[model samples]
Target chain A: MAVPRELRQISDAVWELPVSWKPGMRVPARLYGTRDLVEHFDDGVFEQAANVATLPGIQKYSFCMPDGHWGYGFPIGGVAAFDPDEGVISPGGIGFDINCGMRLVATNLTCGEVEPHLHRLVDRLFERIPSGVGSTGFVKLDEDEFLDVVEQGSRWCLRNGYALPEDLELTEEQGCMEGADAAKVSHKAVQRGHNQIGTLGSGNHYLEVQVARKENIFNPGLARAFGITMPDQVVVMYHCGSRGFGHQVATDYLHVLLDVMERVYGIRIIDKELACAPFRSPQGQDYFSAMKCAVNMSFANRQVILHRVREVFSDVFGKSPDDLGIRQVYDVTHNTAKLEEHVIDGRRRRVLIHRKGSTRAFGPGMEGIPERYKPFGQPVIIGGSMETGSYLLAGVESGDQTFYSTAHGSGRVMSRHSARKKYQGKKLVREMQFRGIYVRTASLRGLAEEAGGAYKDIDAVARASELAGISTPVAKLTPIGNIKG
Target chain B: MPYTYLEEIAIADVAFEARADTREALFVEAGDALMNVMVEDLKSVRPLVRRSFHAQAEDLERLLFEYLQQFIFFKDAEQLLLRVSKVAITQETGVLGLTAEAAGEKIDPSRHDLNADVKAVTLHRFRVRNEPAGLIATVVLDI
Candidate 1:
């Protein structure tokens, strides 16, 4: 597909689409990427971004990051903010996997030490971590108890001995978002999620063991602050979300909002997935409260996974997690809409920013990050395909341009069906294993669809973010072992 | 099977168009497309257990959306890998209702060649259209 004809190039790293491109667009749409990246973007991405610009009360410009791709209502890696009183909340902006995010953990082990035990560790983690389709977590909760899990989030994990006190501090929103009312969540949501706390869902979700090579460390001081001290320090990173629970929450609200959006609020949407309700209206508030429940559920899910990861490390090395220096670096969400204060036209105003496939990269001295690392800004984890390396970045001061939002991952450039036809899963696994990366997966066909070549260059995306000043590179982590579901 | 995957529609998700001479057959093919998306081989999912359910909406588009969403719900909430074995659609004035009987067993990843977890059936250009000789529907499933 060719790039849209009317896209205006603002800079080598930024492009703008005027409101005149679409009838209902209330603001101009901006895209952050290199010319090559933006040019290769699917036409659907542009349509989705333009459609988002039409939402009522949308402030400034609607934006899509370098990793942006086609999505339901907004392009993946979309970022937009709206006035809390006048704007709206749409489940489309948050995505089906509510609070889908990345969590990184640091360990004192080195690559050489882990190399010999790599296969065993991967197998054990695969067995212990519940992966693949329809996999259930070890955590069991009845409907009544499940409500508490959604309400308390990682705090529930802490009480259940799955997390430490410091883990909460290192987490975005301190692991438990406020005003999450379980009562607002549906029974179906609880049933789908109650037993899925720690299970990694299938389709691009993965758990990997990575090494931080010295040559890849761009900012040693900030890297050390995020726990990359040794020359080839080993770390664990996993990507997942609230499981069936979050999907159900998003599904329920999308239908509910769609039923009343036009009849009640008179809000028209270009896409059915973009159905929304006014922020202050009863439907919107209910959705917000319910959305937080999914957010909290996902936070708790990752915390339990972190605990399982620590246990796996401890069991492999025959030492306690604390003895092995296993600690959480940071856990941050990508799919969420949260109320935040940002300066607009020289005045600080509170707005609800809906970041679909984008990360919150709060710069130095920002209020949301942990105080211990506030001087260096929040740690941003950018996960690449298992075949490629991932990066650890920091929020930059200039990120105020997009309200401190940055790309989430190396976005897809090819369709899964096409990728599957181009590469066989078994062959891809063999190739990756030969290159020093051990692999474990639930399905070979699923793995084939995730070949590194299917996505854009991660280096280019990171470089674009830096040039755009939305983020700053800190360190790069090379994968050694991977477990996918 | 009277369904084909639309690779170009939803790059990050899965989209398919199902067609049949009748609405019931169209619904069946649509569910098959959804089931096939989750499991690579539809035959890999044995009809060892049967489930009966109902989905009602005011329109055919919403009806299709509600009907296909049930597969995601079954997999997530009940861990069932089902295929629509029987379906009945009824129109009562402005309201439309669908009752379906599906069969499959609890998903065993080892036995089923799992492809991707279909997160939800999205409404991105979702539709059911009527033609002179048949009906056609387009559906997208978020993976």
Candidate 2:
């Protein structure tokens, strides 16, 4: 497909593809990217974004963050909100990873303090947090217990001694989502999730220890307010999602919606990847319920992982997590559909917001934010590729342009197979080592696939997003050591 | 013929890549390798019913993704062990294509050694490239 000639440049970092450019589109498509990045888009991304624009009740614009790329129904970094009454909910929009997201934990430990024990710390994390595919953690739960996780999320972790109440205060949505009905989830999904809590499921899921790089700190005042002191202060960041439970829920619902799309809804899709059912339909409700369960399950998973990390640190350093000043900076879900109130058509209305490969960057004073951080705005945790620098950002008022959403990560630039064909794990490891970054993976193949060169430049993407006012940079974190699943 | 497995970071280095000759064969081969990475032999179920499907994508890559997603859907939702039998593709345009196919069985716990469920086929590093020997595609599935 040729680049649509009607795409008008709104600014240095934004472009608008008018709804008239594509048939069936209900709204325009807004893309946040540099001139170079906009030109790099392939036909699939444009089509996917356009497809999103055509959805029944999408509002304002189908927005894509700087890291946008081709995805099933919506491009990665896509954000759209729909009227609860008229809009349709597509499982493809939330993605199978469910609440695949990132969490940042601030620590009092400086880089100098952790550098000496970086190897030991990573090894301990690798041991405590089971990684790789099919890796199970020590946590075990029965059906009812798992239901508690589904319904209560991080609160379940707190009750189970996996987390503290304070952690919940710092987590987005308070570490749980409402409307979770475990009964809606299949037995298989529950079974799959029972043993997987605290485990890092493979493929892009990882834990990293990072230090703030000097130059990328644009807001020193905000950083100081957030307790980010020295440039070498060490922090822990990890990204994962609801394990098998989320996969099963998405799988189960895709088929249900497929049947609904054909039999009851009378909707014909151009792509099965766009499988959906009317929001008011039985199948849609069931999926929404089950998906919430998966979302909560992810919160529980991350909570348990946090507990284990604390344990590892305590055991190794002979200090409690609190004594070490380890506390959750923030936890944010990237893939999810949630009910939110936004101004639509000059009036505030409740809508269902689906953000896939995107994060909610609610500005300060939003009622949904936790009290402690309400004045500062929501913390946005952006995970870059292993070799790139990740960032900690704060939501800004300017995000109203994008329904308060931002890109989730440094989007991929190359396919994994291509990376494997072009590079060797050993050689890549050596190169990372030369850059002063240490990486440990379950397989050499996994390491090569996550090579830094395989992803877009994180600095560029972060800058573009910040410049667009979707998210404001708070701190810049450069990885020193990491473990990948 | 047994399909070979190759891992690549194809699109933008965001996803994993797996390839096979036949559509069903590719799915089964990819399934085996993907499950193997997570656990062990998960496709040991006996061939049951042959289910036919017709999936359309804006392009071949999306078609292949829907193809793999269908197998995952069957395996997770219907508890069916689906092994692709045939795959036919007609490319209508640069990013549009139609795929038709048939798959093998119902999943039997006694026979099928189920492993990690694949969440979705991501476009992170997704690609489908034609080679002199055969057609090759790479996908990064969120498992």
Candidate 3:
């Protein structure tokens, strides 16, 4: 359990734990963090990342983002890509929450314009957005409609009059990932997702109205192009994913992969938590297909949520959504697997990339980027803990160091139990109010667990990613009103 | 003996540390604690069948993780609450060989106040060590 001494410091922001530090490791482990942040990592995270480096066909380095935390198999902020032919895919790499991600929307209305009705706006949003554990939304679909959601993703919302075409243009993969096979998903997973669409499941998921401040605007041109104006323009952001269905898919396949890893692949793992099968193997393929279904389901889930938000805004402002200019800035998934082409040791190769608690920060002009955002790099929405300031970043060329990936959110610094014990929910709410932030949630305990103090300093984490050349800061967004599930 | 809820993440862990003169008795006590965490009453349900598991691992820590993970898997997937009937472990060189028998019953949610859903057992702060008193195992789960 000792810290590896062989790590070579690449820079103040980067450290390299070489492959030679451990036997069987195929690649080095590259960690992105300041000295203080790196020191705070639980030693087991380094051990896990070293183990991930040993996986076949790992590219560049098994990279850990600054917000790294100990997780099953891979560290929470771990990023790894494997060659399609030689690499292996592990369900642990994607974690249990498939396609969990964040989305940011821009608004034409400025903070001054909405200040008079801020409380009413927040209240309406809270009521319209179903939240909390096991909460169900208004979207009730039959099996056939659900299948379309699994296959079409956000497109399903557009067809149902829940989203605009422009929103689809701003979403990654146009809000639907390809290769989803509903048949691959279990009936249990489908049942779990039936009433959960558009519902924000509890634990770290939230909807926030943010005020863009003058001091934090790093790219005025880009912000202006995205229709963000004035020092106090208000924008809404939320983080969520496919609910119970995603969890069930992950649970079912973790067992499937565990059995297959022993019987068919003959692979021995250091921890059962790291259970995996070859990407091309039948078991791996099946999980990937099912995972895609969950991804699409989440896309549709967010789309429906967007529709609900739009409805609330229209009702409050006495203006249509188009007039309010509540357009999606971008949506990106932080969890899930994708087949992507990356330059590996000088050659372009196709690999199945697993980004657990990492977000894709593809630079401007990347082919996979939706055409509308081709001029602007993919919008990276980094959700902070309920008490802190969330960030809007853009992928830059410097991200080539880590395959254009960055931290997903303000990572947990304390366990939920510890947070609840340390801070009373009522006191935390009052403190947020004093800071000009409004809060609402179904469970006070849930709110306490998600308090900003329970997480690492998001500003520092986002800055580390920017300093390390993985992502560039575009704007700093401070919350004025918030709702949690 | 009642199992103490030690800690939980998305992944949860309940443990009972006990001592006995024999290893079999210690394992039985551990099983009793595990079953207590899984459900409310141990005496209410009758064991319909006894299942045996034999596994070999390169290391003892991993062997312990696999053992607990297997119990969780069975409990969640099959609605079967397992009680360790017996256990035997042998160490030869660096490898450990284990044999165990477990009994299970259908799940009754009313009896089982499930605290948290454990996603996976993690190596974070994981430990399995020997003391003069007895064997000790501790783990941090990924909830």
Candidate 4:
């Protein structure tokens, strides 16, 4: 896709499309990436970002992070903030998998110690933490019990003996985001999510055991502060979300908003997927409350999965997780909308910030981060392809620009169908094994779809993120074993 | 019922275009496309269980959206894999109504070759188009 002729290079890695780029745009659209990254973005991203700019009450700019790619309405890796009183909230900006995020756990064991028992460990994690299509979690809950889980988030995990108190402390929003309203969620959502507590739902969702050698550390001091005390230390990372619960919530509301958006509110949306209601409206408030249920549901889901990770590791190592020093580094989400206070126009204003396929990288000393890491900023976990390496990053003061947002992962460059057509899952598995990365998957076709060639360069993405100053890399972690869904 | 996947969009999600001469046939084709996304081989699924769905919308677009969403709802809520075996579309008063009878069985991972889970049918590029010869519905399934 050709870069829009009017897109101006405002900075080394930033490009701005003025409001005039599209009709009815209330604000300009801003994209951040190195030149190569920007050039490789799908053609749909620019059009969708411009469309998002037209939404009512969008503030500053409709920002697309370095990893931005074509998504349904707003481009994935998009961020935007709007006034709660006058602005609108759109689910398309939040994604179907609400709070679909990343969690990293550090262990004292080194790669050498882990490599010997790595296969047994990976097999155990895959069995205990279910993956693939239609896989349900070991946790069973009736409708009433499910409601309690969503309302309390990870607190339910703590009560159920699935999580420690510090686990919640290291989590975003303490794993229990405020304002969840169980009454707002529908019975359909309850039915979809009731039994899915610890399972990892499919499509790019996975549990991987990774390793960070000494050379992978970009900022040793920050890494050590986060419990990566030993060279070649092993860690665990997984990505998933609210599963069927979030999808049902988003689907239910999209229908409600579509029926009422134009008819009741008279708001014009370029794409039906961007249909929204004014934040203060009854419909908007109802959707917001319901969305929070999914958010909390996701937090609880990850906490339970973390518990399973610990269980599997303990069983394989024949030692307790604490003995192995399995502590949470941090839990962060990429898909969400939260009410946050930022210095907008030199005044502190509470705005609803939507991050779709983008991570909130609150700078050092920013409100919302754990007190222990106050001087180092919030930990930002950006996952990469199963065949590539991932990154550990810290927010920077300069991140205030995109409302302290950063790229979520090595964003996709190829479509799944295209990648599937080009790669053989069986061969890819063998090739990966030869490269010292053990692999297991629930679906071979899915494995083909997620071939390494499908994604952008993670090293380049991390460098672009640092150069753009949204977040700075703390360390790089290579995948030693993978369990793909 | 004739439908072909439109090669996944830029993201990992899949899209398909379904067409037929009648709205009823369009429903069948679209429903088949949705089921096909989750199950690698539709032929592998047998009519071991049967279920019916009813949806009412003000327009064709919303009706199609609601109808397709039923399969995903059943897949998640009931652990059932289904295909539209029979369907009827009625236009009465101001409401567009659809009554569909679907048949499949409990998702047996051993029997039904499973693929990606279709999270929801997205509104992006969703359409029900009328033509001289027939009707066309373009749907995108978020995997």
Q: For residues A249-349, what per-residue lDDT tens digits would candidate 4 score against the true structure?
A: 99889878878998999998999889799999998999999999999999999999999999999999999999999999999998998999999989999
DockQ computed for model 3 against the true two-chain complex using alpha carbons: 0.09
Off by over 4 Å in 4: B8-10
Candidate 3 Cα deviation (angstroms), residue A370:
2.4
lDDT of 1 at A60: 97
TM-score of each: 0.98, 0.84, 0.82, 0.98
Better of 1 and 2 by TM-score: 1
Off by over 4 Å in 3: A1-3, B1-143
Q: Candidate 2 residues B28-115, lDDT tens each?
A: 5554454443333544644557676567767666577666666645543444555554566665655444443444555343344433
- Backbone clash pairs for candidate 3 read B9-B143, B10-B143, B11-B118, B11-B142, B11-B143
Those runs of model 2 whose alpha carbons end farther than 4 Å from true positions after fitting are B1-143
Writing each residue's lDDT as its tens digit, candidate 2 over A122-190 gives: 889888888764566788777788888899999888887888999898888889898898889988677
Q: What is the fraction of true interface contacts found in candidate 3?
A: 0.04
Tell me the deviation in Å of residue A24 in model 3: 1.5
Better of 2 and 4 by lDDT: 4
Candidate 3 residues A1-485, lDDT tens each?
34568877798789999889888888899998887778777675698789899887688789899988877788889999988777778878997778888989888888889878888998988888887644567987876678889988998899899989988888888898888999898876776677778887667788999989888898997777666677888899999887777877886787788788878887777777678888888888888889989999988889999999999999999999889988898998988889988887788878888898999999888888877667888789899887778889888877878888999987887776667678878899899989988887766666776877778899889889988889888898999999986
Best candidate (score: lDDT)? 1
Ranking by DockQ: 1, 4, 2, 3
RMSD of each: 1.2, 7.0, 6.6, 1.2
Task: Please compute the TM-score of chain B alone for each predicted structure, in the order given.
Answer: 0.95, 0.68, 0.72, 0.95
